[model samples]
Every structure is written in C-alpha cells, then in structure tokens.
Target: MFKKGLLTGVLLFGLFFGAGNLIFPPNIGVLSGDYFIYAISGFIVSAVGLATFTLIVSLFTGKGYQELMSDLIHPKFALVYLVALYLTIGPLFAIPRTATTSFSIGIEPVLANEYKGIGLSVFAIIYFAFTYWLAVSPTKLLDRIGKVLTPLFAGMIVLIIILGLQQLPHSPMNVASIDYSGAGKAFGSGVLEGYNTLDALAAVAFSVVAMDTLKTFEFKTQKDYKRTILFAGVSVASLFSVLYVGLALLGNYFKLPDTFKGNVGTYILSEMTQRVFGPSAQVFLAVMVIVTCLTTTVGLVVSISKFFNTIYTKFTYITYVRLFCLLGFMISNFGLDTIISLAVPVLLVLYPITIVIALLVCLHQLVTLSKVGIRLTMGIVTILSFLQVLSTINGFHYFKTVISLIPYHDIGVPWLLPAVVGVALAIILPYQKITKFKNNAEEKK
Candidate 1:
C-alpha cells in the first residue's frame, strides 16, 4: 500500500510538474506583486479544479478519459476530442515547447555568445534524439529518470523559494502598471497563464497510466481500487498546492528587471540563480533545467506512444513513436513563442468543452437524462465553443460587426451562458425511449 501510494505520487507529480509549470507561477507572481494572493487563488481554481475533475472521471468510469467520453458521447465526438488533445499535448504545441524551453534555459547561457543558436540546435537535436530513442525502446529508463528528476526538481524549487524569501527585504516594491490595477484582473490573467501549463490535460492522459499501475498491484476488489485512486489524488493535490503556492510567492516577492519579459520560468531561474549563487549560478541552473525538461520530454513521448499503441494495435509501437517524435522535432524548430500564440485560441475553445464533459461525467447520477439529451447538450457546447475560438482568432471586433452580438462580452462570448443553456435544453428536450432506458438504469443505482 505504501509503495503503491508512493508510485501514485510519483506519477502524478511527474505529470503535473513539467517545464511550463515551473515558469507560469513565477511569471504570475512578478506581474501580480501585491495582488499575488488573488492571482494565485484564480490560478489554483483552474489548475486544481481540472485536477479534481480528472480524478473524479478516472474513479467513476474505470476507463481512459477518451474511452469514457466516447461511451458517453458519440464516437465522432471522441475522435475530435482525441485529435484536439493530441495537438494540445503533443507535436503542435506542448511537446515542442518542452524542447525549446529546455534548450533556452538549460543550454544557451553556457555557450560562447556567437555559438548560442548553434548550441541550442545541437542540444535540441540531442534531446529529441534521446526522446526518440527511449520512445522507441519502451523501457524502464523513462520511469527511472522521472523518479530521479522529480525529487531534484522539488528540492531545487524549495531552494529557490528560500533564497527568494531571504532576499525579499532587499527587493524593490511593486512598480508595474499592471500591478496597480485591481486584483480581479490580475487574478483572471494569472488563471489564464496557468492554463498554459496544460497539466490538467496531462492529468487526464496520465490517469490511464495510473490505472495500469494499480492493476499491476493486483487491486482485485473495487474498494481497493477506489482507495488507491483516492490516495493518489490526495497526494498529487497536496504536493501541487504546496509547490504552486511557494513558487507564486517567490515570484511575488522578487522585483526583477524589466528585460525579464516573457519566458517567466527562464527569467526567474536565471535571476534568482544570479542573486543567490553569483555568476556560476547560470551553469548550475542550466544543468538543472535541462535534466528536468528532458525527463518531461521522454515521459510525454512514452505516454503518447503508449496511448496511440492502444488505439492503433496494428501499427508497431516503435513505428508510431518514431513518427511522432520526428514530427515533434520538426515542429520544435519553429520555436516556443509561435507555438504558444497559436495554441491559446484553440485551448480557449477546447478547455471549456472538455471541462463540461468531465463535469457531466462526474455528475452523471444527478443528471438523470437520456443519452440523446447528453449528446444534444454536448453538440451545442461544441458548436458554441468553436464559434468562440474562431471569433477570438479572427479578432473580436470583426466578430461583433459581422455576427450577431453575443450577450456576455465581459467574460467573453460562448462560455458560461452557452454551457448553461445547453444543460437546460438537455433537461427540457424529449428523447427516444431506447436511449432513456439504459441511462435511467445507470443513474438509479
């Protein structure tokens, strides 16, 4: 039981604490300054809310997130969700960011000034090479690296927190214009920033891995499985809350240079290392960043490969892994900034839809609706979400001038109102008898 719990903690932390996680809170802290508490609260709502929803989905369905969603909705909806999830988590966005960010923070500083780009290219080549290698091999190496790196990351983070606190008195007061504004804006921005971490999405992906881990322990009874999952969930939530809070506070206290714009994780680590450790701090930080990033890249590769293999049994794992890694590497060459800019609009659309589905799954018993009702609600949500995403990308003004005025401009259109309306419609809509029978049976007990 103890080992099982520890494994759960390890897996959850490994999934949650990726390179983006390291960067976001500190950036929020620096921007938020005195408003740090409110900002962190909002960030926690998205991060922890997603995590909690993921745990609930894993426990009740006893299937992978994709499988559960597909069962609840149509198979076509499941395919769209899976493709969006992959693009969100893999080659198009998150995976490439992993390689690029790691190189920027981990390798660039140590090289001769002229050689930095060349150095980055070389390191990225090697990093993804190893990513591809382990991805194809499918061994214990990925897990071993995760076990080693997660503890080191936790320790390094703790050290950073302590150093920042020690230097707080000497740091200047909050001077940014954004910080002068009310806490609500700061908090809302922070929440949006935290969404960039995509840990919540990763949590859903990793739950299948966690379930497999439980099965290996011979958790024969339903009670044992539930206890194990709950234990794991608590462990992950506790660790994430502590670390996220600590990092945000660290960022809040430090008065950094104006040059430290964008790439928050890299900026914080570089600045803090310089202050705390002097010139040599750069080299130390670079090494730590590389290792942490590499561990994440490898784990993602392995997990994604495993997922694809399950879905596409005919294709060899090696073939799929290599193809995906190569695609990820090609995409990484485009650099981090571009990927992030493109991802935001898409994530804005997809996150609400995913959350709605997960929430419905969790409240399935209370829903007491036919499958047709559920499908109709889901369809409505998806359509509205796509419209919002399009409007965001095409510019809000264009949308306003061309399309009918959406009611909720303050919180953005196609969000809470559409979702609520969909739910109400589902409740009120009539459905065929066959669809109602199974849904009623499942909800009753």
Candidate 2:
C-alpha cells in the first residue's frame, strides 16, 4: 500500500504539474510581488484544493469520469461534457500548449530568429512521437511515469527551488504591486490565477488514468483502492502547494523590471538556475521542463484515447492515440499564443461547469441533495456561464454589466450565487420526496 500510494501520488503530481504549472504561479508571484504570501494563500486553495477535491470525489465514485457525471446529470449530458473535457485536455488546447510552452521556454530563447520556426517544428514532431510511443500502451503508464519519470521531475523542481532560495537577498527589494493592493483583492487574484493551471479539470480527466493504474496493483476491494487514492491525493496536494509557494517566491526574487517582464516564467527559472549554479543548470532546467511537459502530454493522450476507444471500439486504442498525437502535433506548430487565445474562451465557459460539478459531487456524498437539485444547480450555473461567455461577444455590453454586478463577478467567478440558488431551489422543490414516494409505490406493486 505504501509503495503503490507513493508511486500513484507522484504520478498524479506529474500529470498535474505540466506547462501551466511551471509558468503561471511565478507570474502570479510577480504580480502579487511583496504580498506573495497572502495572494498565494488564495491561489493554493483554488488550485490545490480543487484538484484534491476532484480526486476524492472520483475515488468515492469508484468509477472514472463517465459514471461520476452520468450519476449526477443526465447520461447524455455526461457524454457531451466528457467529450468536450477530453478534447480540451487532449488535442484542441492542452496537448499543443505543452509543446509550444516547452519550445518557447526551453528551446526558443536559445535559438536565433531565423531558426525558431523550424526548431519548434522539429521539436513538436519528436515530442509527440515519444508521447505516442508511451501512450500507445496505457497499462505500462505507472511503470514508465510513476516509478521512473516523476522522481526525476520532482528532484529537478526541488533543486531549482533550493538554488533559488540560496540566491535571494537578505531582504525583499521590491514593493508590493498595486495589483494585489489589499488582502481581499490579492487573494481573489490568486484564486483566479489558479485557473491558468487547469489542474481542477485535469484531476477529473486523470481520474480515469489513476483508476486504470490502480487496477494493476490488484487491490482486494474497491474500498482499498479509494483509500489509496485518498492517500495519493493528499500527497499530491501537499507537494503542489509547496512547489507553488517556492516558485512564487523565486518569481518575487526576480521581480526586477528586466527579469519579470512578459510571459517568461520559464526564462526566469532558467536565469535563476544559471545564476545560482552556473550555465550548466540551464540544461537541467530545460530537461526538467521537457520531461514534465512530456509526462503530462503522455498522460493526457492516454486518457483521451483510452476513454474514446472504450466508447467507439471500432478503432483500437493505439489508433486513437496515434490520431490524437497527429492532431496535437499539427496544432502545436501554431505556437503558444494561438493555442492560449483559442483556449481562453472555451475554458471560460467550461471551468465554471467543471467547478460546480466537483462541488456538487462532494456535497452529495455528505448531504442528501436530490438529483433534481444537482441538475438544477448545474443547469443554472451552465446558463449563467453561457451568458457570461456571450457577453464577451459584440453588442453585449449591457449583459456583461449585469453579470459584473454579481458578488466576486469582477474576479471572473460570478456563478457561485446561482449554484447556491440551485441547491436552495432543489431543497424547496419537494422533488426528492416525490421521487422517493413514487419509487416506494412502484416497489410495492
């Protein structure tokens, strides 16, 4: 149990700690500046807390994402939601972004202007090809990633943190930025920043991978497997929180105008390593980024392909893997900016629904919320999310203003009240007793 839990925890960490994980928190740190602690406190809750909650709910379901959603919402919605979820995590945005991030941070800076495009093209091919090879066989995923790659990844991250701390001055030199002026706004910004990591969504998608890997351990009962997942989830949450704090501090250390400019968290990391340990450390940083990105890419491909093949078995799993990998490779060549720009709108719509689902799933286990309540809550949140999305389009200024009035709306999470109302309506509707009484009557017959 100990060994399996340790390995599983590391695997979960690897899957969660990908391109965004490496880049975003540091930027958040710089933005938060001297208020890094207060801001990251909020960041950790939304980021790490969300992932842990997702994993625990998945464990309780003892099933992958399919049944988890199907039980709560209509099966039809489950199918549609899962498809969108998989696509977002797999080829459409995430998979390509990994390659682009790795290229921009790891390879792009080192190359001259003339060679950048070709360099990324060549890198994408090699990266996805290797990801395909690993993902082609999902059963060996634990052996390849959990037992091997994750430790190396974890080690490098730790080394980067340690070396970074060694370089910090006797005191902080930078002033707190106005972006995080007060604790409330700072905390809110941190919470919003967590969205960039997308671990909350990935946790659900990766639950399938975790379940499949757990089967190999041959746990005697479902309860045991869930217990193992709980252990792993705790470990993952703890590790991620620590790393996020460390990375943010490192970002704060490099908060000077020249170093902290633009979306260059990776470059900041590389510069930090080189300054502390010498130019040789840049190789270590690049290798670490590549491995972390590669592991995450492989896991996403495996999860997407395996889930799809199960539903549409006409194409073998490997074939789906190859197809997805091909699509990812093609999309990756478009570079990071394009992938991110396209992703923002979709994620804005998707994340609210995902968060509501995670919350409802956990809430249901503790309280007897009716199915109607769950459905209503999701429906209301979904509609509000759509309204929010539509407001971004042309001629919707009035709608956007209306949504912005919701509590915490300015921070981009306006669906909380709607979700609460959904639960309240579900409670007041009398649907639970009606459904129960109807079931009892039918059983008597």
Candidate 3:
C-alpha cells in the first residue's frame, strides 16, 4: 500500500508539473512585486482548491471523471467532455507548450539565433518521436526515465530556490504594486491567474490513471482505494505548495529589465541560473526542462490514446497511441506561442463548464438535483461559455455587447449566476411522488 501510494503521488505530481506551470508562478511573483505575498496566497488558494475538489470527487465516484460525468448526464455529453479535455490537454494546447517551452528555455539560449528555430524543430521531432515510441509500448523504459527525471527536476527547482534566497537581501525594493488600490480585486485577479495552471482539471482527467495504479498494487477494498487517493492528493498538494512558494519568492526578489518582460517567470529562472551558475546554467536548465516536458508529453499522449481506444475498439490501442503522437507532433512544430494563443479561448469555454460539473458532482445530494436538472444547467452554461469564448477569440464587439446585457457580465462569469439560479429552481420544483397510494390505484385497474 505504501509503495502504491508513493508511486501514485509521483505520477500525479508529474502530471501536474507542466512547463507552463513552472513558468507562470514566478512571473506572477515578478509582476506582483511587493504584492508578492498577497498574490502567492491567492495563487495557492486556487491551485490547492482545484486539486482538493477533484480529489474528493474522484474518491467518491471510484470511477474516471468521464464515467462520473456520464452518470450525471448522458454518455454523449460525457463524450463531448472527453473530446474537449483531450484537445485542451493534448496536441492543441498543453502538450505542444511542453515541447516548445522546453526548447525555448532549455535549449534555445545555447544556440546561435540563426540556428535556434531549426534546432528547436529537430529537437521537437526527436522528442515527439521518442514520446511516440514509449507511448506505444508503455514499458519499463518509460518508468525508468520517469524515476530518473523526477529527482533531477526536483533538484534543479530546489537549486533555483536556494540561489534566489541567497540573493534576496541584495535584491532591490519591489517597484511593482504589492498593495493595489483594491485588495479584493487584487486577490481575485491573482486567483484567476493561478487557474491558468489547470492542475485541477488535469487531476480529474488523470484520476483514473491514479486509481488504476492503486488497483495494480492489489488494493481490493473501497477503504484502501479511498485512503490511497487521499494520500496521493495530500502529497501532491504539499509538493505544489512548496514549489509555488519557492518560485513566488524568486520572482519577488528579482528586478527584471524591460526587455526581460512578458512571462518573466521563465526569464527569471534563466537569468538567475546564468548569473549564479555561469555558462553551463543554460545547458543544465535545458536538460531539466526537456526531461520534464518529455515526460508530460508521453503521459498526455498515452491518456488521450487510451480514451479514444475505449470508444473505438476496432483499432488496436497501439495504433491509436501512435496516431495521437503523430498528430501532436504535427501540431507542435508550428511553435508554442501560436498553440497557447489558439488554446486560450477554448480553455475559457471548457474550464468553467468543467468546474461547474465537478462542483455539481460533489454537491448533488444536497442540491437534490436530478440528472435532468444537471443536464439542463450544464446545457445553459455551455451555451453561454461558448459565446464568451467566441467573443474572446474573435474580438467580437457585438458578442461582448450581448454578454454584457446578460445577468452576469452585465452581472461575473457568465454561467456562474445562471448555474446557481438553475440549481435553485431544480430544488424548488415539485414532482408527483411514486407512493403506495399511486400503486394501489393502478392495481385497482
């Protein structure tokens, strides 16, 4: 049980610790400056909140997130959720960002400007090709690689924290707004930015994988499974909190130049490593980033492939796995920046819906909400989410105007108020009871 729980925790950590996450918090620290403490507190709340919520839902369902959603609604709705999740986590967004960020942070600095693009292309091809091979086999090689890379990533991150702390007293005063005009608004913005990590969403998506790990270890009882998941969640939460604090502190101390602007988190790490560690810092950082990113890519590809394989049993699992890898590679070569910009709108649409679903699943009993009620609420929310996403992506002035007139943005989060209202209505609505009186009346016929 101990071994199984530990392994599950490691895998969960790997899934949650993507390249973008590594880059974001530090940047938040840098931006928040003197406001670093407030921002970090808010960031930790969202980060931990999402993880805890998903863990609770997964534990109760004893099923994958998709299966849980299917129970609440229909199989078709579940399928839609799965597709959106795969697209968001796989080729369209997170997967590509891993490869691109790895190259940019880890490898690009060491190369001459002229060859960097070509170098990144070549590295990506090799990276995805290797990812494809492991994903198809799912063998001991991938396991060994994960075991090796996990420690190395942790060590490098720790080294970064140590270096940043050593420089803190020597660092300049925070010029950026630490105490903004509105405390509530500042905290809320920080919390929202933390949501960009999407660890919680990934937790739901990866919970099945975690559960399977438990089953593999011969955990036959429900009690054992619950304990294992709770342990895993606690372990992941601890690790994330420590790392976030470290990175946030690093960002808080470093005063970046104007050119060092835009997602300054990655730059802070890169520059700090260069300053303290010397010329080899680039290589060290690159290797760590590449390894971390590669592991993430392989995991995502495998998960998505498994999902598709279940729906279409005609194709061998290996075949589908290879297909996902190839497709991901094709999309990733376009560059990371492009992939992220394109994915933002989609994420906006899906994230709110996903959050609402997870919340509903957790609160179903108290809400006395029927499957029909859940579906109705989700349907209404999804439509509004779709419009918000469209407006965001296309810069549609008219859509924005329409959204503003709605109760939420005209009132916050277009679907939030509507979902609450829908839930209230569900609880209040009366239905005829299927009682002994009714049964007796039918029997009289």
Candidate 4:
C-alpha cells in the first residue's frame, strides 16, 4: 500500500506541477519581495490547498470531477462546465501554452536572434510530435512521467533553486502595486497568482488518470484503495509546498531589467542559470523546461483524449489525440504572451465557478446541501464570474466600482464573499421535500 500510494502520489505531482506551476512562483516571488513568506503562505493555500482537496474529492468519491458535478448539479450544466474546462485546460489553452512557454524560455535562448519565429515553429512541431508519441502509449505514463520526468524535473528545479539562493539578489525587489505592499496584500497577491496557475482545473482533469493507475494495483478492499489515494493527495500537497517556497526564493534572488525581460519569470530563471552554469545554462534550462512541459502535455493529451472519446463516441481516441495535438501546435505558434493574454478572461470566469464547486463538494461530505442551496450558490458565483470576465475588458471600468464594494476585491477574488452569501442564503431558504438528498458516502467514508 505504501509503495503504490507513494508512486501514485509522485505521478499526481507530475500531472499538477507544470507550465503555470513552473512560471508563477518566481514571478510572484519577485512581486512579493520582502513579503515573500507571507505571499507564498497564501500561495500554498490556494495552489496546494485547492488542488489537493479537489483531488481528494474525486479520489474519495471514486468519481471523475465531471461525474461529481453531474451528481451535484444538473447533467446539462455539468456537461457544459466539463467541456469548457477540458477546452481551456487541454487543446485551446494549456497544452499549447506548454509549447509556447517552453519555447520562449527554454529553446529560444539558444536560437539565433533573427530566426526566433522559425525557432518557435520548429520547436513546437518537435515538442508536440514527441508529446503525441508518448501520449499515444497511455500505459507507460506512470513510468515516463512519474518515475523518470518527475525526478529529473525536480532535480533540475532543486539544483537551480539551491544554487540560485547562494547568491543575493542582483538588485532590490521590484516595486509591487498597492495589492502587494503589505502582509495582507502580499498574501492576497500570492493567492491570486496561485489561482492563475489553473491547477485546480487540472486536478479535475487528472483525477481519473490517478484513479485508473490505482486500479492497475491490487488492493484487498475498497477502503484500502481509498486510503492509498488520499495518501497520494497529501503527498502532492507536501511536494508542491516545498517546491513553491524554494522556487519563490529563487525568484527573490534575481532581478532583471525591463529591456532584458521577456517573460519575467522565465527571464529571471535564465539569468539565474547563466550566473550558476555560465555558457551551459541555456541547454540545461532548456532540457529541464522541455521535460517539465512534456510531462504535462502528455498527461493532458491522454486524459482529455480518453474523456472526449468516452463522452462523444462519434470520434475515436486516436482521432481526438491527433486533432488536439495539431490544434495545440497551431495555437502555440502565436507565442506565449499571446496565449497568456487569451487565457486570462476565460480563467477569470471559469476559476470562480471551479472554486465554488470544489468548496461546495468538500462541504457536501460533511453535510449535504439541498438542491436549492447548491443552485442558488452556483447561480450567484456564475453571474459574478461573468462580470469579472467583462471587468477585464476595456470600457469595463464601471464594473470595478460595483466589484469594489465586495471584500477582498483588490486582490482579484470578488467571488469569495458572494459565494459565502449564497451558502448562507441557501441555509436561510425553506427546504422542500424534493430538496432533500444525501452525500456520496460509499464504503463508510
């Protein structure tokens, strides 16, 4: 049980820890500056806390997140949410961002300046080609990502963080905005930055993969398997906490100028490698980034392909895989900056709903919410999240005035209070016979 749980945990970490996980810590580290500890504490709360809990919900319930949502909400809403999440977390955004991010920071450093576009295009093809190759063989995923890439990626990240920490920062911390100037604000900044990593969404996508991996092992009872799965979630929380702190500290150590900045996090990391390993830094960092992104791309590709194929049997798994890989290849060529820009609005809307769902689901285990409660709470959050989406656009400044009335809106989470209100309202509302329900408490959990 110990051996299987530990291995499963390692793979879980590999799936959750990629792309945004790679980029955000240091970016927020620099942004947090003197208050990094406070910032990272908040970061762990959202990133590790939410993701671990999300994994646990699926693990203990023995259901995929999409399935869980269907059980909790209307099947139609669940379908819409699942498809949107899969699109954002798979082909449309995440998978391609992996290619663009790896190329921008990892490969482009070694490319000839004039051939940057050509370099990105070439790298995208090769990167996705290898990703598709590995993804086609889903059976090997645990060995390839968990046993091999996870350790190698961890080693490289640890090497850079440890070495980078030995030297003091090149310059003072970057000036933070009003939202990051104090302990509270710094913590909020960290939380919001962590939220942007889009990991909680990945937790939902990857949960089935972990469960499927567990089925391959022999367990005496359902309880035993559930226990092992919970252990894996805890392991991921522990692993991410350690890595985020170290990486944030590394972010604190390097300060690059504006002219030199590409992706702030990537450039700062590139600067660290140059100082530590000199001329070989580019190749080494490139290898690390490639492995980090590859591990995730393979995971997302396989998970979504299996999911789409199952949900809509009109398309074959192989057909979906090819389409996703090809689509990812096309979008990645737009570059990392463009991809990030496109993702921001979508994430803003979807993440709040995700958070509410995760929170409600976790709470459901303690005491079941009536159908009215669930619907009302989700309704409030959905509206606010859409408004947040609009708030990010031009000529939407007026939305801020209304949003500002909400507590903690400054740090980008305006939905939190409203969600709480919905829950309270649910409790206050009259309960009807049809609203009565029970939680998914299988096997005495």
TM-score for all models, in order of appearance: 0.88, 0.92, 0.87, 0.94
Candidate 4 has a TM-score of 0.94
Task: Give the whole-model CA lDDT for all candidates, comma-separated.
Answer: 0.69, 0.80, 0.71, 0.83
Best candidate per lDDT, number? 4
- Per model, how many backbone clashes are there? 0, 0, 5, 0
Roughly what TM-score does model 3 have, to 2 decimal places? Answer: 0.87
lDDT per residue (tens digit) for residues 266-304 in model 4 = 877878889889989999899888888888898999999
RMSD of 2: 3.0
Clashing pairs in 3: 34-178, 35-178, 106-286, 408-411, 408-412
Q: Is candidate 1 or candidate 4 better by lDDT?
A: 4
Candidate 3 residues 1-445, lDDT tens each?
Answer: 5556666777767766877678877777766755666677777777776766776677666667776676666668889888888878887778878888888788777799899878878888888888887677654422644466666787788887887679676442456553332445446556666666766667665766666556556767878877777777777787888988887777777777766544576688788788777878887788777877777777777777778788888998888777777677667778766876787677667767877877777776344555556677888889988887766545587887878777645213677788887666555655521221122335368
lDDT of 2 at 354: 86
Residue-level lDDT of model 2, residues 1-445, one tens digit each, is 7677778888888877898888877777767766777789988987899878887787666667676676666678889988988899889999999998988877887789999999999999999989988988778878789878988988888888887888786344466667687787788778877876778888888888887777778788767777788788888998999899888888777745654445757667767878876867757767888998999999899888888998899999888999999999999999887787788777777778888887766765665567777787888888888887878889989879889888877666788888888877755665552232123335468
> Per-residue lDDT tens digits of candidate 1, residues 71-159?
57765787778777866787778888888888777666677889976776777778788888655654464266546767777777678
In TM-score terms, candidate 1 sits at 0.88
Q: Give per-residue lDDT, candidate 4, residue 312.
A: 97
Residue 144 in model 1: shift from native, Å?
1.0
TM-score winner: 4
Instruction: Using TM-score as the measure, name the better of candidate 1 and candidate 3.
Output: 1
